[model samples]
Target: MKRSKTSKSWMNEHVSDIFVRQAQSDGYRSRAAYKLIEANEKFKLLEKGMVVVDLGAAPGSWCQVINNAIGSQGKIFALDLLEMHPIKNVDFIQGDFRDELVLHELENKLNDLKVDLVISDMAPNISGIKTKDQAGIIHLNELALDFAINWMKPNGNFLVKSFIGEQYESFIEAARVVFTRVTTFKPKSSRDRSAEIFIVGQKIKNIEQLNDFGLE
Candidate 1:
């Protein structure tokens, strides 16, 4: 099969990326593993026996990082639209996170367990249209934020991938309403040319007060 010029270029770039080579040498599932690791190092979000929810965790790289960090003491629940092979100490749910059935399944699996952290690496399928892609990415970030507010315990944390664009301000503002502190981070592993950045919202506050603070 013939690949598009863009696809071929992307493949070539992926092959040449230092992080890609590093991930392979380190036995991580994907290069994205380092992004989470970098974020965790800066934030100190992971702890023993803490419950974590990973949204859009297909390919399981982020889950792998979390699993290693939490070890046998913590639990990790992951959901995605695509299937992922099982990883030890990580519960995998293969389905669209936005679907009611999938959400219920995750909730059931959670079983009254409060999440200590929620991490989302979800990205929209790019159509080469910057505006549309940004909108989709922003929407996904909002959904992840909603999950964090509802499912996370007080003082919990949320780490989500977002795009840098005109829509970014509103997104950060919304995040600030629910979390005591919110910061934007661009991991070294993230491509410099890419507009993608991670938003880390820490010390989740009272959900009831979120609305008053301007968060939906």
Candidate 2:
């Protein structure tokens, strides 16, 4: 089968991408690992022995990064709708985290450990239909945030990938309401042409208080 020009162009660019080459040489599962590394550099989000939850963690590059950053003492509860090959220290749950059974299994694995960071690299499979893709990503972002609020340690952090769109500011505002500090930036590993940006929420406000205000 003949490849579309777009697919051929993308393959060429991906092959030449510095991050891609580095990921291949560095034993990271994918180029996405650098995004988490850069975010951590700026936010000081990861620390040795801290507990974490990773959403949409297929391919496990971010999981590898987390495992290295936090070490053996740290715990990682990771979930995705897709299967991920095992990473030595990552506790992976392969299922839709939205399902009650899946969530229960993840919680069971967590064993009530308070998560110091909740990071999501989750993005919906793009169908090239702008409206549908945007809605799907937004829903995933919301679910990640809600799960973070319930599971995070006091002053824990939340980071998620997002794309620029009509509802973007509203989501930022929503995160700000839950976290004392909220900011968004594009990591160096993210493609310049991509609209993707990461939202970081630091020093969470009291979850109980958020519930009292119905913010949760």
Residues 24-111, model 2: lDDT tens digits:
9999989999999999999999999989899999999999999898999998888999999988888899998668898889888877
Model 2 lDDT-worst window of ten: 207-216
Best by TM-score: 2
Task: Give the runs in model 1 whose Cα sits over 4 Å from its true position.
Answer: 1-8, 211-216
TM-score of each: 0.92, 0.94
lDDT of 1 by residue, 1-216 (tens): 899999999999999999999999999999999999999999998887889999999899998888888889999999999889899988889887767798889999999999999999999888989999999899889888887877889899999999988688999988888889999999999998988899999999886787676554
Positional deviation of residue 214's Cα in model 1 after best superposition, in angstroms: 8.1
- Colliding residue pairs in candidate 2: none
Q: Give the lowest summed-lDDT range of ten residues in model 1.
A: 207-216
Q: What is the lDDT of residue 145 in candidate 2?
A: 90
lDDT at residue 39 of model 2 (Cα atoms):
94
